[model samples]
Target chain A: MGIEPGRLQFSWISSAESTKFVEVVTQVTNAIRALGPNPDFTKKLAEVA
Target chain B: MLSYAEKIREIAGRLLASGAVNMVIGFRQGTIPMMNEPHFAKNPAEAAKLVWDSHCGINLANYLTDRKEKIGIVAKGCDSRNIVTHIIENKIKREQLVVIGVPCQGMVDKRKIALKCPGEITAVIETETQVTATGNGFSQSFDKKDVLQHNCSLCIHRNPVIHDELVAAPVEEQKGIDRYADVRAVEAMSPEQRWKYFEDLLSPCVRCYACRNACPLCYCPTCFVDESRPQWVGKGQDPSDVRTFHFLRAYHCAGRCTDCGSCERSCPVGINMRVFTKKLEKDCLDLFGWEAGLSLDVRPPLDVYRPSDPNDFIK
Candidate 1:
């Protein structure tokens, strides 16, 4: 319920659209990098691991 | 004005006597006022014990998992939907089942009745229009429609999508229902407020797994909670642990849950766990125009993906 909005991304691309897929992936990687790691799941991940 | 109990017994008896099925799964009257037990009838004599009423809220499809015997089962709208889910998920074979479908009105919410009459309910008499509860030196009556479980009141599917036999003609589905009112209200809150809302909502969880066990869709051989080498959730009553458990449980049932209200019904402390699952149900509907357990031909939402699917949330 407390999930921050920027921590996740969703995209739709067909298999033939390789350039579009790479562009979208690069954009998402940059956006997530700006937001940093998700604190909510990171703590739980550490506990479980 | 159909006599459901009598019809159930007749069908069950015939099935068992004719050796069409080895067992009939339905409800028997409980010792308590408003509770009923899921029962298995092996013969005509045992089939005679089967009874049906509004208190038959627990999903009978939960009992169909991994059973080898050819069975006849009494199924309400939600129960039959879960049966379809079981068939699709390989929990049970379609040929192995003889589904006796009943047109459900709704199940009475015992918690609502308790709030109405704050005494130990000694007896309950229910008709199509009213529910009368009598207890120690007190009697109370409420309109039947008012005391329905929250999910039932908003249910759109009142007739079985699949059935071998119908106990009665299908009832009219509820129209003009605002099913996502609660979900929308929660969405309107600030993230911190929403966080506190859920924290308070799940604070009473005892982690008994009744909610998990009650769900016909939840039949994993070994659940993620039970993972030992990489223990996903701590066994203690930590708030974080409780929240994590609820989150994962709801996520696991993304496109599989049929909103049968069994999880909420089985909670001893009366936790409204449907809040979690309902969000996913809404997402599935909006994104994929999908309702779980409606058909055996199509796969669940998460199982199939479309290249042209909407993805506005992406960067």
Candidate 2:
């Protein structure tokens, strides 16, 4: 319940605003990257290797 | 509280005798103290079995979903709210229900009383302002205010929002109560600390779906937890799975929960899961100026979209 807001983002972009959509995507990715990995609610998948 | 039972029985009997409704849904005295069972009265004879007391904490609206018969339901404040939600959602038609509204004081927290008593409680007696618990070796009386269910104590709506008949004059509603103090306390904590607090709070969960079953809002035919084709969550009691289940369920109730405390009351392990829903309730009030199910004419905030709606979270 305490997950950072950046982890889930919602945006509205028209087809005409492709550049704005790209810019917003970059902003969201960077915000999530800064928070790093969440320690809770993430399943530890088995390694393929 | 004692006279309420007599009045409820009288109203239910009249409804049944008049053929106003096919069934009258109310509470009957439970075998054990502090537990009341939902009773369905089809005839006047069965209506006579109906009772009302502090232990009638379960919401009567939970039984009304998609029901086709004309039902006369005993509704307290929270139950009436849920019934309103049900009508708005098209789960049932408003014409099919005859709501007999009850002016509720509050329901007692049995778990709280159980903790205070030294022995098993054999009987519980309630008056206008006091509750007495008698048992094998202990007899204790408590001020009703001290033992009220946490949600009930902070409840703002003690009178039904809508009804066809009144059991008694509407009780004065609670006012100027800080309903979201606990939610604010959780918000004040750091993310890690908040996570730890919830993890500890939910650790005792055993994956039982009692909370979902008790909720009037959770009328989904196939809840996320039960969907196997996509498998939204695991069936076992894994910590992460448990968190996902609780969080997702809380999300499902976002704009619709009445804080009736049925989920907490039905929990076998006594987990206060209202922590999750109450936060969303506060947010709905703060962001959308919405308190759920107070009106039949207005739609819920999340159910409709407007250009002026808040979009600060969106990039």
Candidate 3:
């Protein structure tokens, strides 16, 4: 398997870096994954697709 | 002009002198004539090879995830937007990075420019910092517009989005145009026509996912399509299976894609991938009045929802 390419491999990768947006994105992506697509709602998508 | 080369060298020298960064990610001449490839330089000698010019068009920001240690990178407008998306998504930390901002009006669509300016030319120059290209030969100079890529005309930023150091005074701002004019035409169609168009595009998909890998926003640790434990998509080539992967990606990235043209550029099977992304980009702009990744302060639309979020089908 090819190596997993990181977001900025061509640049410095740092763990100590603090993101001003981390709290917001965590709240966001978690909210998204938590709300699994509604089966009934997706059923409509199924029809549309 | 061709000043990016010397500027990169000068910046690399300063970084080396200060021990500010240990490596520099920039472009080096490629084996192919007039082609460039990403390069990593650890020392001043190697850094001296860094180059940024018309041919240095590849976006280097995609390489930044999980990489530890301080390093500097060269980034253009679209590439910088991608960096912002990664930072906001927590995929890459924003610190420990030194972005060498290079003012790029636009880069030549190599293949197209080559087709236009066949054989050696005396000089090829950017006519406008980010809007025009002009090439000169023995006795003739023609507007670079003749060979500029479609993306260039619609480019809103000809300058880098983030940078520790500025290379060449930043170019004047360029107005963003509705580059997805063609996508709007498809949307103007009735919902039935829109579905038909999408189905047609999805049906031809081989599900190779060259589109996903090429996308700047697609930086997930594990793509949903690749999940086998719960099995989102079995490794099948059925038309229906292919459509599932395609639409899911578009829907996931509905309000997030910047339409940098990389997904379509990276597709090998000749799928018109742009149509779907552009349609979604336009819808995000129209419905939510939002575009993705430009501002780190604004959460991606899908990731944040208002209690009053509009849903026409909600009961």
Candidate 4:
């Protein structure tokens, strides 16, 4: 629940709005990059003994 | 509060006697003090067993989901709101319901009252403004205001929002109450701190799903936690799974949770899950100017699209 707001983004884009789609994609990617690797929700793989 | 029980019984009896409703859902005295269980009265005789008190905290609307017969339910403010939600959600039709509304003062918190007495509570007596709990050798009286459920204390909707008949005159609603102070406090915390806070809050969770069971909104035939084909959450006591369960459960009620406190009241470990739902409620209020279950004429904000709706969170 404490996940950053930018982790998930929602936008409505028409098929014709190619530029808007690109801009939103770039914004989302940047936001994810800024948050860095998410160690919280990811399940850890069991180590071989 | 006791007087309301007589009127409730009379109304339930009349409803059953007149054949206006096939069943009247209300509360009966539980085996223990301050714990009332939901009762279904199919005839006038059963209706006489219906009682009203400060402990009728379990939401009656939970039992109304997809019910077929005509039902006359005893509804307090939150219960009526949830009934409205049930109708809007198409879980039940409004035409099949005859809501008997109660002007709720507030339901007392049993946990709070229990904290005052050193021994087991054998009996609890309630007056209009005071609660007296008696045990083997001790009796303590608490001011009603001091022991009200957290949600009830902050409730502005003391009167039923919708009803076919009123049990008593609507009590004056609480005015100018700061309902979101705790939510706002959580929102002020940094992400890491908030995560730590929730981790501590949910650590005691045993995955019993009592909260989900008690919630009227959680009528999903197969909740995400139970789906094994593509399991959304693990069944064990993993912290992430617990968080996911709580988060997803809260998200499912985004614009629909009435803060009835049934989820909190039903929790065996007494985890206050209202903070999770209350945050979304505050968001709904702030972003969409909406409250859940207030009207039948209008749809919930999340269920409809309007150009005027806020989209600032979008890229």
Candidate 5:
């Protein structure tokens, strides 16, 4: 559903600690959100989020 | 000293008074002194009975997360570490807690301590400042540190991790080699010999699930063992099956097991569950350089993964 670990890291660590936490959570939550609500880990996460 | 006791009462009473939590879990003198079971005080009146000392070692925070109502808890060193993991895992919300952190010298291990006492045997009894065993119609008092649980023997984190109030100034953390260094002798055995070693140890297991039930981290509403639809382990007495249950459950607590020793302590069958849990405890520290539940910030290593994570087995 998402591009790559390197891409995730860039989006995540490219900023300060608070920004980093938000960046990573947003990226990962967004990636899982992209998979839609199907009850599999990715989809279920998105549905909840 | 009355004030110290009263201070404990005050923190618990105020937390109850403020509507800060729905229940406050602490230790109360059980029918027996040696038996420190987790206790709950749903109101200020019940909070008065909460007590402390080396005897108050049982981790009450283990009970907090599973309940739907918000609760505060009296946490000692080991208890707070377990609480830390519950927070990291999202098992309990941090805001709902009112931690009454108390310094711990160590907690008495009723079973181990009983053997060392003067009696051929009798019940362990306690008072506010001293603990005595009444056996053979006589009583003798011992210093609290003289007979403590195996974990507390090597415990360094003798202060609460997260506390709203402190009971006493924190004691300097103790340092000692792994008390379960005996497990290494078992590790030196040949595979076949090691197999026999575990075979000897776990053979007594009745599959009573006492260890699982006692574990703070064994939080699934339906555990893997209970999944009858696709059984992770069959309900059988076969040696391998017994081994699988012990091995998996011990590993399940890898970074998560704070060596609270609740598993082996609560087991009615007298299995040496410490051997397995301590091995996992040492391995997690050695391999990952990680300790579970020490802080709120770090995610548990197993539950949160990294692409660069190490594994010698992976090609």
Candidate 6:
């Protein structure tokens, strides 16, 4: 439940609204790029492996 | 005005004697004060041992999981709600149960009382109005309304939603209660402050799964903590492991927890684990306008998805 908000995104777009969907995806991609990878999950994954 | 103990025994005994049910799940007097054991009455004679009081905080629905026997179970508002959850989840059948509902006032917080009176609590006596805690050298009494479990005080449903028979007329449901004040207080904090708040809050955990074991909703055949294949949670006293366990446990109960307060009650170190579950409960209510175990017909929020369901935070 402590999942960082930046790591996840949700938006509603109809099939007709392809441009809106692309815009949302681009915004999310840029935001996540700025934030970088989720260290907590990556560290946990490494420990598990 | 409710004489629950006598009524429960009478109803349970009748159910057993009539051969309507093979077992009656209820509470027996506990070995110590402020604790009651979840018990199974196999015969009319054993049904005589069934009692109800402020101490019967353990959810008896935990015993109903995968039980094949026709059961007559004593259920408070929260317990009845959990039974509905169980029925919806296919943990048990509605036809297999005869719910003996009790209109709850509230269960007392023994820890609060213990803090008020500093000694071994030898005996605790409760009435509708007050609770008296007695020890060797001291006797303290407090208003019943003042010491109820946080969940119980703000409970919207004080009457069983589904029951075959009631021990008494349904108690008035609590109205206009601010159920999420503590949650709101935490929400007001900065993200870093909140992270620190929870870390400090869970610092006392010894990784004992008493909270998980006590919850009726947590009847997973193999809990994630026990999974060895790509083990999800470490079974150590490390603070991160403890936090992970708490986080996942609360998440698992997202749409199904009835805010019964058993998890908090069962904790040895008195951690308020309800903080985690209540946040989920509030979110479900806000997002879906749903409360757990209110009806058998409706699926839990996470169990079913609609095309129109909100996804505003998603890309």
Higher-lDDT candidate of 1 and 5 = 1
Evaluated at residue B83, the lDDT of candidate 3 is 76
Report the poorest 10 consecutive residues by lDDT, candidate 4 chain A: A38-47
Query: What are the per-residue Cα lDDT tens digits for candidate 1 across B1-315?
Result: 238899989999999999999999999999997799999999999999998888889999999999999999999999999999999989899999999999999998989999989789999987778889999999999997899999999999989889998888899999999999999999889876887899889989999999999999888999988887899988868778888999999999999889999999999999999999999999989988999999999988787666756775432
CA lDDT, every prediction? 0.90, 0.93, 0.68, 0.94, 0.73, 0.89
TM-score top scorer: 2
Off by over 4 Å in 6: A1-3, A9-33, A36-49, B312-315
Instruction: List where candidate 5 sits over 4 angstroms from the true fold.
Output: A1-49, B1-4, B66-68, B116-130, B305-308, B312-315
lDDT of 3 by residue, B117-205 (tens): 54654344443443232344332334555545566657777777777887888877666466777886875776556656666766666
Worst 10 residues of 4 chain B by lDDT: B306-315
The DockQ figures for the candidates are 0.36, 0.65, 0.02, 0.58, 0.02, 0.20
TM-score of candidate 6 against the unseen true structure: 0.90
- DockQ order, best first, reads 2, 4, 1, 6, 3, 5
Sort the predicted structures by lDDT, highest score first. Answer: 4, 2, 1, 6, 5, 3
Better of 2 and 3 by lDDT: 2
Q: How far is B216's C-alpha from truth in model 5 (Å)?
A: 0.4
| Per-residue C-alpha lDDT of model 4 across residues B1-315, encoded as one tens digit per residue | 679999999999999999999999999999999999999999999999999999999999999988999999999999999999999989999999999999999999999988878999999998989999999999999999999999999998989999999999999989999999999899899888898899999999999999999999999998899999999898888788999999999999999999999999999999999999999999999989999999999999987888786775442
Worst 10 residues of 6 chain B by lDDT: B306-315
* Interface RMSD, model 5, angstroms: 17.4
- Candidate 2 TM-score versus the reference: 0.95
Looking at model 1, the pairs that clash are none
Worst 10 residues of 1 chain B by lDDT: B306-315
* lDDT-superior candidate, 1 or 4: 4
lDDT tens digits by residue: candidate 6, B1-315: 337899999999999999999999999989999888988999999999998888788988999999998999999999999999999999999999999999999998988899999899999887778889999999999998999888899999989999999999988998988999998888788756777788789989998899999999999999999998988878877666788899999999999999999999999999999999999999999999999999999988797877768865432
* TM-score against native, each model: 0.90, 0.95, 0.72, 0.94, 0.78, 0.90
Q: Which pairs clash in model 2?
A: none
Q: Which has the greatest lDDT?
A: 4
What is candidate 4's CA lDDT for residue B34? Answer: 94
Steric clash pairs (candidate 6) = A9-B314, A10-B313, A10-B314, A10-B315, A11-B314
